[model samples]
Target chain A: MKFTILINEGPYQHQAADSAYQFAKAALEKGHEIFRVFFYNDAVNNATRLAIPPQDDRNITVQWAELAEQNNLDMVVCIAAAQRRGMLDDDERDRQGKDASNIHPAFRISGLGQLVEGGIQSDRLITFGD
Target chain B: MAMLHIVNKSVFERGTLDSCLKSSLSGSSILFIEDAVVSAVNNTAVSDKIKAELSSKNFYVLTPDLNARGFTDADLIEGIKGVDYAGFVDLVADNSNVQSWL
Candidate 1:
């Protein structure tokens, strides 16, 4: 089965991100395809590379980046949400004349239409939120 | 395919329920869970909106959540069904996707 995962909360602040990551990992391990992982609301924070956690804590952003790298996952951060939360890729930063871009390379900024497309293309769309 | 939309916050507290209603496709199912159970009550400010949607969408309130919040079936708006956890699972299985408005 092809599944699309939606995450609606920022990392560490809520368990939604962790649960979504675990579900995505389990689905991949079970030999199921993950069509896309759509980050919306505060979840767009997960795609930022500037987040730094203490040495004792798990780095959620790194985990997602590594998972995406290993699986060649299509991890998308909603552009509207990302912009609102100050998460920007190089193109967005350049377009908006921002001084810096914090978005990790593993994730791409896209429109909400990608989320609608995920629902249309995937067999199941599972949402994890606050 | 139809979607199962879950609203976990009170309509009085947030616009999650309204957004869920607006985003829901025709023939989708809406389930009120957690604090959202408050919206199932009769005569609330949003009751008219809920009643209006009933003609096109299926409405359900989690029985445990309703009870936890000190509400009962009699407190619910007409056409709203109170369901158990098992029913929640069944609704998820019956729908093609799950969209939680948090």
Candidate 2:
């Protein structure tokens, strides 16, 4: 099976991101393919590289980055959402003349078309939010 | 086609569960996670609403979330099965699509 994940809430503050990550990992471990992980709404915050969680707490951003690297996952952050929430990649930072880019390298900024494509191409589009 | 309708809000706190149940087809599955697990508890104010839908929709609750909220299987309404994180993955795989009520 191929699954596309849609996350709508940020890390730590909500369980949506954590649940989505756990679901994705479980699916991959079961030999299912993760077609993509699309971050929308406050979920775009999950792509920020500046979050420094407590030492004993799980670093949600790092967890996502490691997972993406290990599984070669396609993690997308909606450009519209990212911009609204002040999340910036290198290109966006340069284009907008921002001083810094905070988006984690594991995620790419894209349009909503990526989300649509995931829904169309994947066997199941599972959303974790709120 | 059978779909999975995931509700993650408390019934007392939000009307998301009601909306999800209203929109879900008869054969679809409804899985309660996070704060929504409270809806799966037996003898609650909204338990009747959930019970009424059991004949038409399959009900499920995430065990971890339930436990975290101080609930156990014994407290869950009859006919609502419990699933862990891995079981959540299985539900997604088993269903044709997922509609999360946020």
Candidate 3:
């Protein structure tokens, strides 16, 4: 089966990010194809590389990056939401005249069009949010 | 087509479960995850309502979320089933589409 994931909340503060990650990993382990993982609303925070979780706790951001790298997943952060929350990739940072880019390399900032495309292209679009 | 309706909020905290139950059609699958697992317990305020709907729609709760909340499968309502992350994936794959009640 082909699936798309939609995450709407940030890491640590909510369980949505962790649950989405677990679901995505389980799906991939089951031999299902993940079309894309779309980060919307506060979920764009998951792509920020600056978050440093406690040593005893799970680093949700790194978990996502590693999962995406292992599965060759398309992790897209919504450009509008990313802009609202000040999440920036190198290109977006340059475009917005920002001094630094915080977005993790595993995630690329894109538009809602990619989300719609994922919904259309996949068999299921599962959302994990608050 | 049978849709998979996922609820991630607690019924005690939000009306998401109520709205999902009301809007979901018969034959659909309802999977409670995260805080929503609290609703799957046998003797809550909303238990009767959920029990009544059991015959109409399938009900499931995520096991890890329940365990995180210090709940066990024995705490689940008679008709509701508990599933792990792999089962969660199967639910999505088996259903026609997913409607997450946030």
Candidate 4:
């Protein structure tokens, strides 16, 4: 079974981000293919390199990065959501002439079409968020 | 025909989830998002067979929903599966019909 994650809650806000992490790791253990991980709405915050979680709590930004590294999953941030949240990629950063690009590797800005596709290509499509 | 069934409510609030999926006609995707993912792992009022039929039709359950709820794929209810945004796009691309069940 191929797996895909649609995270709607931002990483810092709540359990949505962490829950996605646990599921991704489990899918791999089950021998299921992790096709992609999509962050939408506020959940796109997980892809932003600028997030700074308190040292007391979990480092969700880094956690997501580690999850991507372990699973080799495609972490996608909805372009619309990212822009709304002001998470600009290198190209967008350059175009906007921003000083730095905070987006991490293994994550890219994409469109909602990816959500529709996740439903079609896989044997099943699972979604997470509030 | 397929529907992207989104249980976006924070928690499994009574009949909201059942209402969400039941309200949707057949051949639709039921995504338990946010706190909705708990619906997939919890003991559902609906029968397992019915849920299985839903998945057999290729109805999808997005994975991140489960994760957000602190669940992993192994903890998912029987017959429920996961799909990311890319795969989600493929779902809409493959199927010509999509009605969002909120």
DockQ of each: 0.20, 0.82, 0.94, 0.10
What is candidate 2's CAPRI-style docking category based on DockQ?
high
Local accuracy of candidate 1 as per-residue lDDT tens digits, A1-130: 7888889999998767875786687677767788999999999999889888999998999999999999999999999999988999999999999999999999999999999999999888878888
Evaluate residue A30 in candidate 2 and report its C-alpha lDDT on the 0 to 100 scale. 84
Candidate 2: where is the Cα deviation over 4 Å?
A: none
lDDT of each: 0.88, 0.93, 0.94, 0.67
**TM-score for chain A, candidates 1 onward in order:** 0.99, 0.99, 0.98, 0.90
Which of the two candidates, 1 or 2, achieves a greater TM-score against the reference?
2
> Which candidate ranks first by lDDT, i.e. highest?
3
Least accurate 10 contiguous residues by lDDT in model 4 chain B = B93-102
TM-score of each: 0.62, 0.95, 0.97, 0.61
Write the residue-wise lDDT of candidate 4 on A12-130 in tens digits. Answer: 56766775676677667656787888888888778777767688988887887887787677888898888877888898789878887878766888899988787677665655665
User: Candidate 2, DockQ to 2 decimals?
Assistant: 0.82
Per-residue CA lDDT of model 3 for A33-79, tens digit only, reads 99999999999999989998889999998999999999899999999
Candidate 2 lands at a TM-score of 0.95
True contacts kept of 2: 0.93
TM-score of chain A of 3: 0.98
Q: How far is candidate 4 from the true structure (C-alpha RMSD, Å)?
A: 7.4
Per-residue lDDT of model 4, residues B3-102, tens digit only = 5555555333656665665576666666555555566664656446346556534444567656655778777666667776445445544554444333
